[model samples]
Target chain A: MSTVAVMNGNYAAATAARLARPEVIAAYPITPQTPVVEYLTLFAAEGSLSSRMTEVESEHSAMSILSGASLAGARCYTATSSQGLALMYEPYFRASTLRLPIVMNIVNREMISPQSVWGGPQDSLTLRDAGWIQIYVEDNQEILDQTIQAFRIAEDPRVLLPINVCYDGFYLSHMTERVEVPEQAEIDAFLPPYEAKHQILDPRKPMAIDPLTSGYLVMEYRKKHMDSMAAALGVVEETDKAYAALTGRSWGGALDLYRMEDAEYAVVTLGSVTGACREMVDEKRAAGVRIGLVKVRCLRPFPKAAVAAALARVKGFGVIDRNVSFGWNTGIVYQEVRSALYESGRTLPSVPFVGGLGGEDITLGLVSKAFDEIVAAVDAGRTPQSAVWLWAPRKGVKA
Target chain B: MSALDLLAEREDMISPGISACVGCNVELTLRTVMKVLGPNSILAIPPGCMGGVGVVGWNKQSGAKVPVFFPLLDNTASMLAGIRLALDAKGRDAHVVAFAGDGATVDAGFQALSGVAERGDRIIYICYDNEGYMNTGYQRSSSTSKGSWTSTTPVSKEGQGGKRQHGKDFPMIMAMHDVPYVATASPAYIPDLVRKVEEAMKVKEGLAYIHVYNPCLTGWGIRAEESISVARLAVKTRFFPLYEARNRKFKITVPVPNPLPLEDYTSRIKKFSHLGPERIAELKDLAEERYRFLEAVSAGGGGRA
Candidate 1:
């Protein structure tokens, strides 16, 4: 096992790409994503990794380059964020619909308009309908680890679709952390080379990849994407087990539950907030408070079964979303969770807490406050409203 | 990825099931583009004429058997850049090309295209300039030459003076990027057009632009058979000069030969027939201004080598 240190999130991502050994990497770096291309270029120049890097002109071109490469049966990857991700929305959906196992790393950033460069889930959340399997990472290590795992999950012939590995910009991207740098041989043994089954760029077996389809055909194509997404749950679980065997670290397939057994209260969260909530739960448990934390690692598959089981015995459940779905009075994830539990015939009071919109911090103090509200509501024989706003400080307070 | 290979493969690669107009320049442009790009080419088209016309479905165009990526009109360049990165991840090299109309390239996609070109990405951007937005009806576009009449600029009761702006100088604008290659060609001169495409393909790196002056016979109110004649007149009258820019060096490929009077060229098209003395003078002045700008560039006046 050799050790290689990277300075920034971009460098971390590039190192992951090198270790993952992607065959084709097409990308155009925008703002935060530029460092990724810079490091990849350096890697390619130094011949540390054997990969072909196409320096495209824009984020849109970068995504399109992958569409062709993936369809041609090459293991493909790319990175972008904010307006750049918005620019790539069109093909983002197409990549998923065509079931191309292309992996993308989105350095989550807020969209421009009174423009800000801070970290947020705005970019990846906006593309929820693009048919890509999106996973949120809380730290640099998760960013590196999830990125390597994304290819395995996405390229599983059973679940052939694109994946977006998202991490908070500036926070997780620039912050330094101790990431377990896996050896190349271990990675090679864990994840096999991408072997496309039906689509290929070989002149010997020619095929037209993206042809126009009628409305009916379009519906069926989308249905297929959904079906495959559902199939990914099992694949993710299996892959997690396989990866665990290789790395000796176990990450949950759909949801990572921390100290949930015998707990009466649970907090549903994703990304970096999960880490803060985990700490709070541990502290709360020591004080004899029946509190636990459930971190959602996979967002696309919805993890309905796993979520239901996690919330099965909990008395009061609350969901914290970094993104808001206006008019729903709840975050999009809250809505999905409610629907999943409702369909599973489970009767429980789940409160929706919308916070951290546009890159606001999700502090442990906020998690404690949310728990207090839940406990007080439960004690007072009330479940509070269907949705609640958390950490919305008074006017003049900086987010 | 040579022009000749692209031309030779057109018949076999691109099938003929598209919904393009019977005499559409876009069809010809797509045919030529796919032929030269070879089999490993990824085609990213927008929701415009080319997307709607080039390949409708699997059985539609059997001509070029390659991967075709269709994105929304405004996102072609940006999406292509992403595709290039993904391809690079696999350690396999592939060419990515964006083929869009003048409206898609110069108007709706201007910012994204400019950003892409500025970065010097390794992809070829080809604009099939057919003067107007023909797919959405014959609407006048920025690329529409002065005094040309379209549905928006229909013939006035007095029968003179329609639209009055010179076509946007996109090739000149692209030269500012100092990209690896830039050229102008027309289907009327297939061999020359193919030669430029061949040269652009060989670079294999950095941004390349090829602006073709494709004539819309239906929009121009000319007989389908007069497509070549109209194109030749455009070149002869110096309205659309042919040239190439490489490594910041501008070289005029087809110089004005025995330049014909502007009236002789304008007399043949109904769109230009309404032009009176004053409007004709305006058109001539615009053409002369364009000619001088290009001539200056060719002589190394525009920061080019």
Candidate 2:
């Protein structure tokens, strides 16, 4: 049994966490992500969720508190955005290294310096190698469903790693959409009661949880963590099927292919921008252009084989990134997509385009323009000259 | 509790073969604290000499028979608070403790410590005061006493090898939080420290804080044998007064009548050898000011109870 309601992404994520019934939730308030915390507090206050809510001083303390709770054998949760996520970097890495299956919602906001509160995937993509199983959500419905499934994948006996379910701030987090939230009974059946296998702070069986591993064993711990991530790659698919069997919905497991069959060229994207890409593909297809979209959902435990196989038949692909991997000039996803292609001996005329940054509108027009560049590059029989930056303000030219 | 009971705890709870140096007062404090905390204890040890020395190491056998968790240096209190709440939620009676040092408690970790106290978290926070950041090679911590020589406050000029800023009055600060229990114990006084730990373990209301005086031989430039003597002089001279605050009622646990001169305590440690008699008098004034403040707040109402 599930209820259909018009809700924002944060509310959907909060509903999922409530249904999942986390034992402990410690989070600090940050822009675009505060509503999730607020909603959880409402659940705790209204006698809905029995989760213990710990209001912390900073993002660092929030993660640290959750780490303690998770290691002590409890299902834990927390939420943060850009700077808040960066502030939690220390314990964020520790949470994964300690193998605590904590689920965090990162309402993706642009990283600052020229301070911005806008939506972007850069914040979560930057921590891809932090030993967290990161997945980007397409919309509010996906946000709700994936968060419930994330616990199942994260707490898997073979993959006791943290999960960062990222959804673009404001674009999806603040925007209301129709989300079908499953019943608590369905959630329980989907995500069984968390039983920790690795470590639990029990007095009867006393043992050090995170001990000082020697240099000799440091590699051993890292190997195990990485192997757990590899295991999660498989668990992500299996759990998505399980979640669909329970809820009648799936997040396309790892990567979502949008009309790529017999397509001449495709562009890779994730998050809300994927919505624009899908629209662009439809418009281009109606106009007799063979343009397609590949939404790389799981950035960590990256679907290299899945992506490679998806692109193996396609002729040319362009990567539309909302983030720029500085100095590398290419976008973060561009590097991974290119590697996936080269690994399978299938390098096409790939172009990396940076757009929709700092909440800038990544409209249907901009996505279509990126697809045009891919088509032109394929026709020219050459790769793009350089990475393209869209919707730039002309210097010294007013409006 | 009987002395035999405490001794039995020593034999049973404290694991041997730790690599701590001779006369490491923190090691003695840890061994005794663990005895009272028992097997049902889960210790969140932060980055400090007590945690790093012989208690835990690279693939080495842990010096704790009970569960030990290594949290970051500055977030021990909050970490232990999380562990405490988790155990509480599970209906488990595990006593979670944060074993930290002067640097971790007063300097880097002060914000987290204050956060835990403000949240009224139920955990025993034992700070083994070693004066400075001795774990990182005798660096000057905010708790490093005024006119104490640390590597960071080295002597650049002749006869000037001490920090000018006074160290934070941390225990009194904890008492100000009006926590369930706030006490100061000395490693030299095992039974008294044991009593404080037992009291803290019984606290189901909120936080319990114990600031134990553990003199560092390496940082203080004192010989190994001088550790206990130094600890004793610290209490006798009113430098480190033993006290407890419960329910906002304060008490001076160890009375110091006709206290020793400040130099009688400082002169033995080479780190304070650069301080002249005049500077020692200044330190004495500071110690007296703190003691007077504590006395004023005592439930005994001004003077020795």
Candidate 3:
């Protein structure tokens, strides 16, 4: 039996990790992601969490500790955000290359320059090529569900890679929502205990790991890693179906479509902004406009085929990215969507939308405005060369 | 049994031969230490002379009989701590150890090492301090002695400049962490070094740290045969004093009552040959001052200084 509880994203993440029963957990505190570590330690203190928890001094040591634990054939977990993610980049990249099945919750926070820390997917999106399978969630419920499924996907022999379950900070991390906490027995039945087969650190069976290797062998390892990532696409779908069978809830694998069928225009989104976009799609449909919503769940191992197929019938589409690509003059996901379309050999008129940076709210008004631009581009038979800014001038504030 | 006899009877954990300097005492220190740690150990060899010499090995082959790997240069201690936790989780008893160099210990890796000590993680950390980054063409590290000429701290053609700062007293720093055990060892004193390793292994709770002072032959420009003797002079002159601290209780392992003159040690090494009378006297006074502080700590019941 599962219990339905009202909690924030951090609590959901912590609850999911507890149910997964990781053998070792090491995490350092950071804004937005701080409460996840606190909750885990509290669980351990109360004797509910059986994992050997270590309070690491830095995110670098946190990831390093998990890497070592995973190398020793133990399931591991951790959480971080923004600057903390940047600090752990060394071990974070190595964790995936070493193919350790460590699950980390990235409570997505904005990277600092002028110093703002409300919410954004820029933290995880900037590291999309770091080899970890990244899954962005829409709400607290998905935060709990996907983090639980993350262990199964990462520990799968066909896809033995570290994974990141990323969700927008403050928007979901601090905001309360209904979450279904799965039974321990149910989660145990779903995610079997991780058993290392490829590499391990054990005195009984001595072997060297990450030795000085020739260029030829290094290339071979990289090819194998790529193959595993491609293989993970299938594993993700399979795990989603299996979880749905057990829990009667399924977050669409890779990409979640809302009223996408028989629709002419699509508003593509990721993370917490998907909720507002879904409402906007419904409102547009009620007003007799044929529009839909596409929420990108899995960013890495990018579901390129599914994305291209989903937009095949639509006259045009617009991607609403909360993070920018800097050089591309558009959001990161906009480029990704365009690249996937390019592979499909379909050149459709599309609009690029960039907004909601640094935890700024991506309100329904902004999402509806983005849909209008997509429709305008499609009807006019011309794609805009530059991104449309979803900006709203506040009272007494300059543009 | 004697340290030599104990070593002769025990199986050597390190592989027969790969590559090290002609007379590298760091290599000897590693071999002797691994023998004491034995097969029931998991070793972390970070980037250093040992790692560059293929201690972690080429391709898939291992450099030691026990499970060994190259940890990142700045994460050896934390990685070992993780290994210890996982091993304990499996109800398995094995010594989780790190054989790191001073560049990986006192410099970049210090924060992670300090974290492990404070957390009371049951792991043995052994740092082979050969003064500087010897494997990287003798670059100056925080562990490099003052007045020593490293590639990065080069002297002028007329023998003018060298390192400006004193080397960090790293073993004493670890002792202050109040970990289960902290000790300084030397390659010249095999018995004392062996006993320290034995003591580190006996520490079942918290961290056990052993810092070994080894004089580099190739990097420091010393004769291959004079490697062990030069290392001996370091201890004899009270420059790198041999001591141990159990839970902050200090004890000089090999007390040098009538210590040799600082020139007796510095005159033998080319790195320090450029030092004039004033510089050599400065080195002598610094060593004496450090020794006096150690003596006070030892006499004052070894609490916190």
> Which candidate gets the maximum TM-score versus the true structure?
3
How well is each residue in B234-280 modelled by candidate 3, as lDDT tens digits? 99999988888998688887777789998999998999989999999
Model 3 residue A358 lDDT? 87
Error of 1 at A78 (Å): 3.0
Model 3, range A13-57, lDDT digits (tens) per residue? 999999999999999999989999999999999999999889999
Candidate 2 structure quality by residue, lDDT tens digits, B242-297:
99999689988887867888788898898888888888888899999988888888
Clashes of each: 48, 0, 1
Give lDDT: candidate 2, residue A235: 94
lDDT scores in order? 0.76, 0.86, 0.92
Stretches off by above 4 angstroms in model 2 are: A392-399, B3-5, B8-12, B57-61
RMSD of each: 4.2, 1.7, 1.8
Error of 2 at B202 (Å): 2.0
lDDT of 1 by residue, B231-277 (tens): 87888887787888896678878887467877766777777877887
